[model samples]
Structure formats: structure tokens, C-alpha cells
Target chain A: MLVIEGLTKRYATGDLALDDVSLTVPKGQVMALIGPSGAGKSTLIRCVNRLVEPTAGTIRLGETVLTALGDRALRRARRRMGMIFQEYALVERLSVMENVLSGRLGYVGFWRSWFRRFPLADIEEAFRLLARVGLDHMVDKRADALSGGQRQRVGIVRALMQDPELLLVDEPTASLDPKTSRQIMRLIIELAKERGLAAIINIHDVALAQQFAERIVGLHAGRIVFDGPASDLTPEVLTTIYGEEDWSATIRKAEDDDEDEPPAVEAARIAAAD
Target chain B: MDAAAAARAWRPPPLIEAAWLRWAVYGGALLYAVLALGTLEVNWTRAAEGLERGGRFLGAFFPPDFVTHWLEIEEGLLESLTMTVTSTVFGVILSVPVALGASRNLAPMPIYLFCRGLIAVSRTFQEIIIAILFVAMFGFGPLAGMLTLAFSTIGFMGKLLAEDIEDIEKSQAEAVRATGASWFQLLAWGIQPQVLPRFIGLSAYRFDINFRESAVLGLVGAGGIGDTLNSSLDRYEFGTSAAILLIIIAIVMVCEYTSGFIRRAVQ
Candidate 1:
């Protein structure tokens, strides 16, 4: 379980990224966060891990207060939370097995880990996870040699190797194709379900989030505008979250949208429709 | 809109407007070149008179006298090799910490400034000038040459190594941090893997440079092939001097090939 209270993050430039936001996730529940660009989605997730220090907040993971901890205690608390990145941030030159083994860095001693002398049990677990993701054949290959889908699979397995209590997934499907995105999403959900793990997935695709998550939380301009089941997310709620666009027309346009148009042209088309 | 009103509204765009500045720089460079050319004096008659002596010297250089000065050349070549190996090893080892300290992304502001200042001081003087100072202090031996080369290597390797560290993918390091890795462990996992191959290649290149410098270090009585060549020239033994020069060329070519092979293998 995770609990957050009165989270506020004001950057040094006086820009309020997150203002008085608060949320919670019961154990084994999958929550999807959906929002427009610069809607404070990333700031919220990073604040949970204290990667982005909140100006005023209290984050309690189970019994531990992460925001109140010191440097050494914060490091210890971080080991319980696993983070997946949009870019699949594996050390490029390291082999797939080494990258996986690095997930256990917090548990192992510095000298042992520095020399890459991971314990036999950790090594075995890494191999088993790699085999589960069908990457056993390429265990010796460098991270840069894998395809995008394969790399995401590796990222999932590495996060799982941490044996984390909470998974913080940031845009896991942003750079992936539709089919690959679905597969990655399915893999993460199934793994989390199997382990009875709690997860907060930051996603851009509303339909995919509705398809996968049991609970949906919509954010707008640094505030939570909607929080309910997928069935409760209506066109009116979507308009309130995304602004005054016609939801039905935009959904139809998205289905037939060509991929060749630049982002500026797309913005102009949206404005014209509005 | 009326045509006259549209024409009145139109305004020409602003230009860079620095053409005069550019022309002034060009003119200054041309004047400096002309003045530099005027400073060097040449005497054609004296040059002609020296041509006959040069021809005789060239004639004496043939067959190289390698068989006669073989012992002296062997000693000088060996000394240069020792100096190159020793200086490169010490220099690369010392450069690692300095490079890490100089990386703005890694070290605090004070440490970064201190490391950068040290690098700048080492790079301010040429290797020959540094060698001259060291020879004065250490008294004209191979110690002076090795020290000079090592100091220069710290400058070259530290500057490049800092750049390589700064250019690494930041997300990789952030991922490591998210895994609860300590700072040292983060460096071992995130930074070392990215920079190791470049570090090895640079060390090899520095070795080759130091070897070449060693051959000329003896010119200032710092002990190497340069000293042997200097003595031979002083005794008017053109044949021995030519033999030493050929040997130096051969060794340098061999080092180049070796360094290239190493860089390729590591990559």
C-alpha cells in the first residue's frame, strides 16, 4: 500500500508543477494516470521515490515515511520501489545478464558488486527472469544489440528482479508500436498480478489505460479532475480533462489519423476543430 | 489594402552588420604574415657555398655505419622504451582521479574548479619547455624526461576523459540510482562501462606520443636517443647520426601499428 498527503512541488523558477495533489493505491491494485503534456504526471511519480523532492508532502509506503528519511535511510527505502523508464535505461555496453544482476546492487556489498561477483542465488534469479521473458538466448549480448520490444522485456525483468513492493512505471509504451505496446502492457500487468504487487503506470494512451487498469485517475493542470473505475470515465469527464474538444470527433479522427503529419500541424488541426 | 499603404508598411529585415569587423580581422592576419616574412633574412650566396659541404655529408651517410655504432644506438633505443613505458603507466594512473574530479556532473564546484585549474597549468607549457625545467631541477637524466611526459599525459588524458564522462547518457546513471545503488556502485556500473574503451584507446595513443618524445629528450641531456644523436653530430659522424635517425623512424612506425591494432581490438 502507498499513501500520499497534500503533495506540492514548486520549482525554483516559481513554476508550480504539482499543487496540493493527493492519491493512494491499495495493495495488488493497478492504477493508471492519464494527462496531457506537462500535466505533472512525471513529477507525481518521481515524488513518490523522492527522486524529485516535494516542497511539502508526506509519503508513506507501508510503515516507512520515505520523505522524512535521511540519505542512508532513503537509499534503503528506495530499494523497495522499482522504477521503469520510457527509454529502457540499461547500461548499453553491459551484457543483458550484468544489467539484470545490477538490480540487486542495493542488497550486495560494495566490493562484491564492484567486481561483478554477484552471489550465485542472485545470478540464478536473473537467469530465471531472463528465461521468463524469452531473453535467455541473448544473455551474453550487450543491451544496445536488442530490438526495442526485446529491450522493454529486459527492462521489465530487471525491475522484477528487485523484488519490489511497489512498481512505478513511467511511459512504458510511449516509444513502442501498437502491438508491441499491448504486449508490454500485458506482460507488466500479468507479472504484477502474479506477484501481488501494487503499480502506478503513467500512460499517454487513454484507450489502453482503460483497457488495462481497473481504476483510472485523470489529471489536468496539476490537479486530479477525475478518479473512478474505467466504466465511469465518460465523454464529459474526458472533455473536462483535455479541454473543450469534441470527444467523439477527436476519437474518430485519431482512428484514421496519418502518422506523417508533424506535431505542429496536429496541434493546428485540433485548434481548428475546437 | 491600397498598394501605397502596403508599400509603406513593408520594412527591410535587419542584417548581421558585422562585415567591417570580419574585414578588419582578415587585414590584420595579412599584415602579420607580411611582417613575419620580412623578419627572416636569407643569404643566397652563403646557401650556395654550403651546398658542396652538404653533398659531402650526405655521401658519408650512406651504408649508415650501423655495424660500428650498434652498441651506442642499442643503449639509446632501450632507454627511450623504458621511459615511454614508465611515464605512460604513471601518467594514466594519476589521470583517473583528476578526470573524475574535473567532470562537472560528478564532482562539487570547488573540486571541479581545482581539477580544471591543475589541467590548465599542465597544458600551458609545451613538453619541451616542461622537460627543460625538469632537467634543471632533476639534473639532466631520464627522470626529467619521464616526469615531463607524465605531466603532459595528465593534461591530455584528463581533459578528454572529463569530456567523455560528461557526454554519457544521464538516464543510465539515474536508473542506477533508482536501484538504491551507492555513489561508488553507481560509478562502477554506470560510468566505468561507458568510458573504459575510450580510456584504453587514449592511453595507447599517449604511449606512442611519449615514445616519440623520448627519442628527442636526450637533445637536452635528459638521456635518450637524442643524446646519442647529438654526440654523433658533434663528432661529425654523419653516418652514425643517419643510422640513429633511421632506427628512431622504424621504432615509431612499429608503435603506430601496435597502437592501431589495440584500438581496433578493444572496439
Candidate 2:
């Protein structure tokens, strides 16, 4: 489980990006953090990894207190958590195998890692992960040579290679088409379930969040407005969470409102749209 | 009435203001114009008067006196060429470490500051000034010229190499760091790859500059064909001076072509 208490982040310019915010997730749970722009979603996710260090906070990862740790200790703690970025921040010049093998760098000896002398076991694991992601044949290809979807798949494989205790995905499906988004979401949810890791995702698509996560936490202006089962997320609740009065008008603008269609059918309709 | 009030509230004071700037530019220009008119007029008149005398002197230069000193000139030019080549190699070798140390990406704060300060001190003087200083220490030889070129290259390449370091992608560095790489490891893997091509290009350009500079370093008794050129000038052998100038120009052109070819081949 992860515990955050009284988290506050005041940047150098004295802007309070996150003010007294706190949230928690139990082990093996899929929790979606939903918010519009400027809701501090990305800031909150970065704060979890101390990328955006909080001015004041108490963060507990299981029994380890991460917020009070120094740089070295924080780095050690960060190894237990895998962070997947929206842009899939893999080194473009490096091959897929090298990028995945880099996931084990924290565990590898400093000398071995520096020389890229990855252990045979680690190399085998990297190849296995690549195979799992349907990129076994592309192991030697540089990251820049891959398509966007292939790169994201590689990104996920790299994250999985870390064998992390906690999985943090920031807008994983934001850049993908609706069908691809569903596939990515399914992979994330299924992988988290299989690994029994804590997965906290920041999602832009409401429907994807509702379908993929058992627990949905709605964020509005750095505060959680709704925290409950996905079934409890009604149009009225969405309106409250989004801070909009005529929320139905937004959903009504969708050309297809066929309730009987499968999720894939809805994905098809969205794919055909602008 | 309400609409008028809203319009009045919306108006800003001003977007562009240049009153003080205009006055400052005008005042500086006026001061420079007065100083130029006072200081340069006499010099210009003297230079104009000397032009006729220089033309008469140049008229005698066509029939060069290469007969008496052609062998000596060739020997000295060969020495200069050797000095130029030697200095370029040493200068590039010396600059690599200094450039890496001064680069903020590759070095820690203490090392970066120390190397940057050293480069600043080295670059403060012209190469001739440095050669003069070295000539006093080493007693009038090619060694002095080599030392000057090496120091100057360190200064020039160090500053440019640091800037190239600053321009690399932060994400690549962060990704390397996220792997929990040590400072040295991150620099080797992350910074080196990003800056290597540019660093090589800058060093090649510096070699070209040092080649040209080496040809003239002997004017300060640092040992090159410039010593011959100066001697020729003193003996009123303008034709020999012209030949030395032509040789220096030809050497520079060859060096330029060589560095360009090597750069393209490597990069």
C-alpha cells in the first residue's frame, strides 16, 4: 500500500501547485486519477516519485518513509517503483534490448552497468519481456526507428522489466487511437493484476478509466472530489467532479450514443471521428 | 454609459516605451563621433602622406631578391610547417581534457568552475602575447610557439565544448540518471555521445586557426618562417616577404581543405 499525507508543493515562484493533498492505494489495486488540465494531476504523480519534490509531505511506501529520505536513499526507493511517461522517454539511439536492460541498472553492479556488462539472466529477462510485448524481433532496432505504438509497447516492456513493486503510468493512452488505447489499458490492468503491483494511472479518457479501474479517484483543482467504485460514477457525479453544470451537453455532442454497442464498437465509432 | 466605462477600464498604459533608450543611443553616438573626429584625423593625414612613400618602396619589390636567401627561406618555412603540425596535435590533445572538465554536463561544480577559470585566464591574451611570454621562458624557439597554440586552443575549445554540453537533451541525461548511474557513468554514456561530434568539429576548426597562427608566431622570436618574413622586411627585400606571404596563404588553404575532409569522413 502507498500512503500520502498533507502533501504540499510550493514552487520557486511561490505558486502552490498542490495544497494539502493526500491519497492512498492498497496493493494490487488499479486506481485512476482523473482530472482536466491544471488539476495538478501530473504534478501529483511526479510528487509521488519526488520528481516534483513536495515542500511538505509524509509519504510511506509500505513501511519505508520515502519523503524524508536523502538523494541516495530516494534513488534506492525509486527503483522499487516503475514510472511510464507519456512520451515514452527511451533513449532514441539505443536499441530496444539495451533500453530494457537498463531497467535492471539499479540492481546491477556499478562497474557492470557502466560497461553495459549486463548479466546473462538480466539479458534473458529483457528478451523475454520484449517477446511478451511482441517485439522480440525488433530487439536490435533503435528506439527512433520504431512507430509510436511500437515504442509505447516497448516502453511498457521496459517498465515491466524493472519488476517494480509499484507501477505509475502517466496518461498512457492519451496519444493512442481509441482501439490502441483500449489494448494498452487492458495490458496495464492485466499486467498489474498478474504482478500484484499497485498501479496508479492518470487518465484523460473517462470511459477508459471507468472500464479499466475498479477504484476511480476524480481530481479537481488538486483535490480528490470522487473516490469510489466505477459503477458509482454517474453523469451527475462526473458533473460535480468536472465542475461543469451542463455535462450532458458535452456527452450529447458524441455522434453515436448507442448504449447496446460493445466497448469495441464505441471504440470503432470514436476511431471514425475527428 | 456602462459600455464607455468598461472600455476605459480595459485600456492599458502603454505597450512600447523607448524614450530613455533613444536618448542613450544618441548620446553614445555623439560622444564616439567627437572622439573619432579628434583622435583619428591626424593619424589619417599621416597615413595618407606615407602612402606615396610606401608606393615608391613597393615599386622596387617586383624584382624580388630571392637569389641571396632562397635556401634559407625554404629551410625556415619547413621548420614553421613542422612547428604548426606539432602544435596542432599537442593543442588538440591538451584541449580535450580541459574542454571536458569545463563542460558543466561532464564535470562536477568544483571541477567545472576550476577549469572554466583556468580557460578564462588562458584566453585573456592574444597568441602573440602568450608566445612572447613563452619566448622569455623557453629562450626563442618553436617550443614557445607550440605552448602558445596549445593554451589558446584550450581556451577556445573549452568554452565552445561547454556550450555544446549545455545544448544536449535533458531527457536523455535524466533517463541515464534514472538508471542510477554514477556521475562519471552518466557523463560517459549520456553527455559524451551527445557532444562528441560537435567537440570533434570544434577541435578541427581550432587546428585550422592554430595553423594560421603558427605561421606568424615567429615574428615574436618564437621560431617560424615569420622570423624570415620579418628579416626580409627589415632588409627591404619585399619580394622575399611576398614569397613568404604566398607560402603562408598556401599552407592555410591546404590545412583548411584537410580539416574539412577529415571532418566529413569522421562525422
Over A116-168, each residue of candidate 2 has an lDDT whose tens digit, in order, gives 89889889988877776677889999888997777777778777777888887
Candidate 1 at B225: error in angstroms? 2.1
Candidate 1 has a TM-score of 0.87
lDDT of 1 at B33: 100
List DockQ, one per candidate, in order.
0.64, 0.36
lDDT measured at residue B171 in model 2 versus the true structure, 0 to 100? 63
In angstroms, give how far residue A183 of model 2 lies from its true place.
Answer: 4.1
Deviating ranges (above 4 Å) for candidate 2: A173-183, A235-242, A249-274, B1-39, B42-49, B52-116, B223-243, B258-267
Q: In candidate 1 chain B, where is summed lDDT lowest over 10 consecutive residues? A: B11-20
Model 1 alpha-carbon miss at residue B165, Å:
0.6
Report the Cα lDDT for candidate 2.
Answer: 0.78
What fraction of the reference structure's interface contacts does model 2 contain? 0.27
- What is the lDDT, from 0 to 100, of the residue A222 in candidate 1? 85
Worst lDDT 10-window in candidate 1 chain A: A250-259
